[model samples]
Target chain A: MHEAAARNGITARFGLDFPSFALDVDLVLPARGVTAIFGPSGSGKTTVLRCVAGLERATTGFLAYDGQVWQDEARRVFVPTHRRPIGVVFQEASLFQHLSVMGNLKYGMTRAGLSPEQAGLDAIVALLGIEHLLARGTKTLSGGERQRIAIARALLRRPRLLLMDEPLAALDLKRKSEILPYLERLHDELDIPILYVSHAPEEVARLADHLVLMDGGKVIAQGPLSETMGRLDLASRFADDVSVVLPVTIGAHDDDDLTRLDFASGAIVVGRRPEPVGRKLRCRIRARDVSLSLGNHADMSIVNILPATVTALGETPVPGHILVETALSGGERLVARITKRSSTQLGIRPGVPVYAQVKAVALFGE
Target chain B: MLTGDDVQAILLTLRLAATTVALLLLIGTPIAWWLARTKSRLKGPVGALVALPLVLPPTVIGFYMLVAMGPWGPIGKLSSALGLGTLPFTFTGIVIASVVYSMPFVVQPIQNAFEAMGNRPLEVAATLGANPVSAFFTVALPLARPGFVTATILGFAHTVGEFGVVLMVGGNIPGKTRLISVQIYDHVEAMEYANAHWLAGGMLVFSFLVLLALYSRRKDRVDA
Candidate 1:
């Protein structure tokens, strides 16, 4: 183990051989904020989270969280799941059927040798907006309500790390929207680092500060969310979902029923937003929605035209289309997907200035 | 109106049933838990052994138990070594035979309940800082309450209704080993039809009420 690296972040190396599949991964994740493990289905994302939670014992594995060794196969030292300070919310809201809502929340607190007041049970219940549900049975709660209770129960354990495995996958769209705000609040308020396993790109773009991309039981790419999402070489892997997440501030609401959002590079105006001015938000710009021209066209209807320089070009899965990687004057990156014919006609190359017209921008409220 | 002999028999029967149910519950819980959760190859053979008394005649179990507790049998030798002499024709002897005869009644329902719970609750409990032992007591036990209730009633009722095993092992001793079922059998043998009718009708009503309670509760659980 590298002492300096282990002290600052989580270090994990795991290898397992199953009859149908094999998993081998080496990861160093930051010790704070949400880090999403994103991949397609059957890509071993959940398995990675399970291994971290000490639920699945990898045949050959070593894991250390912020300098505390949890598993080391060579030393024959392994801490069992219950002994590790972790809170896990499984895909299904696995609340105890025999326990009431409040009973379920207190189950972990009692085991941790803390009373309800000491564990701050009331605050957690209020955070999840489940105070009215304390007296109800688990069977009668809706899917979203049950999930809220499950999250609250996990939190009451006072875990040092939290692992969520697609906690919203089982809920309908309406239920998902209802629960997403609570998750955002957790990401904002909680000091514990969260390891979230998700295959949904929207969830990753909206919530993750750091990203780990996986495929076929392996880690393909990992870094800060914006840096990794803008890599041209990995653009084909994202396929139609290639987009960049940019942190922007609500600048002002204009008189023409529009709101302006300002990032490092420049400002973009969109339909009126309900948030107050100066509030921070995240916006996603898809590669397919961007078009580049050699000279600015003032007569065009597009309002988000910004001058950028092409940095690199990479091949996409589509035969004729190519991915264009560019940098704004302020050092923020953007990607645009265009045809091979347009690339040759405009003689687009690295360091060539071009005007990028962003056709749409999707904003995610914080 | 019942005779003094009949009253004594009823008391002895209740005592035997209560003792057998208590012993079965203690011994059956771990076996049922293992059967419900184990993936070992011994599961098949062990399950078959527990269920053997359900299909085999009580006389067979009684015959083997009688031989085992006799003067020269292995159990008899051990008891003699421990200063217990022999166990046949004693209240203790009948209680052991009743436990063996009603083994399946206590184990199967509890095993079914544990199996129906799946592995989710235990996993949840473990993540909540409960060790395996703590989870069993806090989560698994409460979740399987219905199974315990069914097992208790079935074990007690089966022990009270057993005649062949008790008669074969206990030899119909008057107050010491004579139970309600054995007493009713002796009455019929003596051509005392009136006494037989009194004891037999009571047994019939008791059995009906037990089954009624079990099924009605099952219906309520289904409705819930």
Candidate 2:
């Protein structure tokens, strides 16, 4: 229901200036879908999520989202965390350790004013695949499973927005991979906008529809995945960064036991099973795994080759790994880790054309 | 047949213990919660006051109570003014003294439980959309069930065994304020070992069972 017309505008003004840091920068995020704020540790990423959820108020300014005005200091209005229509998943899982999983889920649902029917307990159970876990005590669950339950519990409240602070940060690599698909599902399926904070580049590439790149508590760059990622000069500043995302479609599978991915820029070869037709796939090429060749290669075991233009060449903070920012014809930017010796031997320079011999293409789950 | 005194004493003891527990629950809970959660500068003095009965000579509390509730004391004058007559040496006076003397027994367990439970659960409940008061009932009190059990049993048991305070304040007045402890002491002084033995033995069994229930219930909560 549309609240009184006065309640209709939801613009979250997240600008916080700390003594030696700025926790957040200004932005008006879209009202729907997942908006992942990606940054490294100590970069004030979680502070942004905290400010939006009203767990910690921004030092100054207002939170406006949807048509509802959640916070405005000028109007002397600030909703406390309890009154705010926000659900947060802390990195620690934050499950009610004393209560059974079902009890924990009901703890929020019972207080949300909506009945069980409105929140759809059964539907959320199926959504997160937590039906088997519902009756178990929350403490007994594994890290990955606990995060899934946490997400489910937050979603069950039917929140206006979900703020997750690196919810999978504590999980192991295997657990992280398993939770990724479920998170991807939530991103695509849920109606509420999610402000997910993570420093994981691959995660940002796969799950985020909009990326707010933060560094030192400032919004350094932000836009749709492809548009902002092209600022190869901007992304080059992050030290020892790996993997550059390439948005490509499954062209077809190869007989030599590999999946052929056709990017608008160039085709890539990866070892993955058959995927359904026409679905977009994010092929992750680790910067270190990709080596540059001045000319086309003939004897290499590497299966995929692409003609990439040298966009920016700079020495990485960590020596030996030269940061190569290259662009595909489709305008998708890819960061590669090539050795300086190869840079000099190939006479590599900015604006020079080269072949990106991708050693492996890790296809993200659809 | 046995004399009427023993039966009357038993009835009086139960009435005293029950009333004492009710009164303690009313006053002790808020104080326990405060001791558990407060960061105020008043904590040290309040804590020392609550635990005074555990170490202070019972006769000291009794002596002060007697002086404070005498006909000329403030409370005694006020009650007499309201037409209640003298309060000390009465059943109501014994109940009041028992509550004061057994406060530590009721408050310690509740305070420990609240401290161990911490503020996280309450904060989580707040973020879940429940107000503070509702969160206390739904989250905090339920989790502190073992503390409540311990407080109730200890307070009741301690009140049942009260002697010095009742002797000083209630003055061994039968059918009005005489409790089991005073009755047992009277039987022994009169060399009626049979009456004293039965009364003392009954109290021993009652106290043992109360402790067994407390320990076992605490174990169950720990396991849960």
lDDT of each: 0.91, 0.79
- Off-target runs (Cα >4 Å) in candidate 2 are A1-28, A37-48, A57-61, A73-76, A92-101, A133-146, A169-178, A198-206, A210-241, A315-317, B1-3, B67-86
DockQ scores for all the models shown? 0.79, 0.46
Per-residue lDDT for B1-224 in model 1, tens only? 57799999999999999999999999999999999999999999999999999999889999999999899988788888999879999998898888889999999999999999998899899999999999999999999999999999999999989988998899888888999998888888999989999999999999999999999999999999
> Which CAPRI category fits model 2?
acceptable
DockQ (model 2, Cα): 0.46
lDDT of 2 at A180: 90
Model 2 lDDT per residue over B114-149, tens place: 899887677667668877788888888888877888
Clashes of each: 0, 11
Weakest ten-residue segment in model 2 chain A by summed lDDT = A1-10
Expressed as tens digits, the lDDT of each residue in A1-366 for candidate 2 is 223332433455567776787765777676666777887788888888777777677767677777667777777788877887778888877777668998888888988976778998888888788889877997678888888888887877888788888988899899998889888788767878888898887677677767788888888887766445434555454454455666678877767787777877867767766676577876666677778888887887876778889888755556776778888777767777777877888888889998887776667654
Look at candidate 1 and tell me the lDDT of residue A37. Answer: 94
Q: What is residue A304's positional error in candidate 2, in angstroms?
A: 2.1
Measured by lDDT, the strongest candidate is 1
Best by DockQ: 1
